[model samples]
Target: MNLFENAIKLRGFLAEDAKVPPSDGITEDAFSVLFLALMSGTWDIATNEWAPRTTVHRVVCPGPWFCGFTRGMKRGDYVEVEGELYIHDYDRPVVVEGERSTAKRYVSEIRAIQVRKLDRPLLVIDTGEDG
Candidate 1:
């Protein structure tokens, strides 16, 4: 199987309330909305084995199916987000003096596919239910 098949789950409080903006794509109409924000701080590494493998922070933008939950979410509220992991390399233009060069910028991002608010005990839980 490919690396993308390995999905990870993260539980943390949002740095701020999610921002919902109308979709800008040509395919998207007025009904579209996006949830964009950062899942701040660090994952509870001691509680689970997956927490230690992730970065301290993650830029989360849940897909359309999960966007509804963002409307009532507030900063500091607990949330559980599931996403596929991928490492992206971007070419950033850097200039020293007058010469310009492109530098490789690597970013570890999780493209969130599903998100849910956590109201019960424990940061991470296996619901034992499938989609």
Candidate 2:
């Protein structure tokens, strides 16, 4: 028996509106792509301070169902995503030491299974007084 899984769940703000390829007379076959930015922090033992980090992930949502579902999403909107991890490889032109060359680039993205828009929590001010 063999067991293997590749899954990811992320909650973050949308970096920008969902992008889709221009219609080629077939709108129902387009794929919706989303850029999600997640923030995190870690305590540095040596520096004794907090280190902040932000990771941007590309999420691909396929089919007309996902496209319509994500149509209302925009930049700065908080959302949750569940998906499988996938790595895509492509060739890109790069200049190396003043020489133009085509290089293979690999990008890791999530193939979204589900997506949900989440309401952000409001900040509350606390005063040290009994009501």
Candidate 3:
């Protein structure tokens, strides 16, 4: 499922059992990359209702996969869903990216949510129904 579904379905599980994973390295996958791209696109999709300007990088796949990397991804870090982040999976329909060995499995504790910045502008994940 995508972020929206993760929120509605996976979040419950995270809060209960998804041990708040200690910051660590992680791998990545195609699914993770695609998801992030869609999320990045949400910004422009919300403002304009027509052909967009400048081919923006809605999302960027961080390559086929990385070996030893962490979630230091900034607003422009071609992310590929770096395994489990700071989640507390409590056994629910959570989305996991596997584990740290290859990837850090994770569940969306917070999805389709906004940043806590008064002027940083809002960010929305377009978790379409297809997910």
TM-scores of the models, in the order given: 0.58, 0.78, 0.18
**In terms of lDDT, which candidate is strongest?**
2
List runs of model 1 lying over 4 Å from the truth.
1-4, 23-56, 120-131
Query: lDDT by residue for model 1 over 32-72, one digit each (tens)?
Result: 12233443354566875433232245545645544455666
Model 2, runs deviating above 4 Å: 20-26, 95-101, 123-131
lDDT of 3 by residue, 8-123 (tens): 21111011111112334332432112223222123356666554332222212232232112223334333223222234434334445753333344443222221111233346
What overall lDDT goes with each candidate model? 0.60, 0.88, 0.28
The TM-score, computed over Cα atoms with residue i paired to residue i, of candidate 1 is 0.58
Q: Residue 14: error of model 3 in Å?
A: 20
Cα misplacement distance, residue 86 of candidate 3 (Å): 21
Worst 10 residues of 2 by lDDT: 20-29
